[model samples]
Target: MNGAGCGSCHSAPGVWPEGEVGPSLDSFAQQTLIAGRLPNRADILADYVRNAPKYVPQSGMPAMPLTEEEARDVAAYLYTLGRR
Candidate 1:
């Protein structure tokens, strides 16, 4: 999650200071779709977060500059949200 700056746009219950730009990501794991377009599975999420416009044409999220490995790591972390 380092250097991805996800906290700059999204807010979670205990992740960081609340972000004012985008929607809260607190219940990301339980979400059914990514950016309201693609499936919420890990592989799709990793790719979507890495390149948002590729999946959601109207997404406000810019493409994240994460590597393949880093995107997977971010996906893994997102899956742990709202479970505890």
Candidate 2:
């Protein structure tokens, strides 16, 4: 459950450090798509995390190869980061 990927670019509340390559997950659940097309559903997000290159040939996001459970956990965590 160490979804510390959240710490990669985001730190100390809403401040995303300058020069960070990845976007902040602080409001990820509110977003509509992974990279503008894929549904932002937990399962879909998980798949994207595992196979981003297959979905988008030229994406700057790299695949994380997360297990289905990990993806679900991460997605759940992301969902909670946004307002209801």
Candidate 3:
């Protein structure tokens, strides 16, 4: 997610800048829901990360420009948080 700018809003372990705008994603894998709404399933999370506004209309998270594959990759990585 180099240019995707996820780190600009969320703070994930090892992700630079440690953003404070959005919720921290350090324990994302343990979370049961995405943005406190949708189920935290892999496919759903992937799409949501790419287009958060679609899932949560009032959310501050903007739509990412990543492709399907890149979004999937990002979701997969996010699912690994706090598992180590």
Candidate 4:
């Protein structure tokens, strides 16, 4: 997701320079809510990863140019953040 600039705004365990533009995704697996509103499930997380604006129109995050599978993959990866 480097090409999508996810690391620029989010920081996992090993990633660095987690930008302040968005919240750090360090403990994503343990998060009870996604974006502070939606349920923290894989499907919801995938949708949020692809089009956060759809869930929250006022969200600062824009729609990501990723396919459904790509978004799902990203969501799955995010879910593994705090697992280790």
Off by over 4 Å in 4: none
Cα RMSDs, all models: 1.7, 3.4, 1.1, 1.5
Order the numbered candidates by lDDT, best leading. 3, 4, 1, 2
For residue 9, model 3's alpha carbon misses the true position, in angstroms, by 0.9
- State TM-scores per candidate: 0.87, 0.71, 0.94, 0.88
TM-score of 4: 0.88
Q: Write the number of the candidate with greater lDDT, choosing between 2 and 4.
A: 4
lDDT per model vs. reference:
0.81, 0.66, 0.89, 0.84
- Tens digits of per-residue lDDT, candidate 3, 1-82, equal 5468888878988888778899999998999999998999999999998899998999899998999999999999988998
Better of 2 and 4 by TM-score: 4
| Candidate 4 residue lDDT tens string, 1-84 | 655778778766666656668888887898899989999999889888889999999987889999999998899889888875
Error of 1 at 76 (Å): 0.3
Model 1, global lDDT: 0.81
Ordering by TM-score: 3, 4, 1, 2
lDDT per residue, candidate 1, 1-84, as tens digits?
Answer: 535677778887665656668777888888998877688998898998889887777768889999999999989988988865
What tens-digit string does per-residue lDDT give for candidate 2 at 30-71? 898887888888877777766778899797776775788877
Candidate 1: stretches off by over 4 Å: none
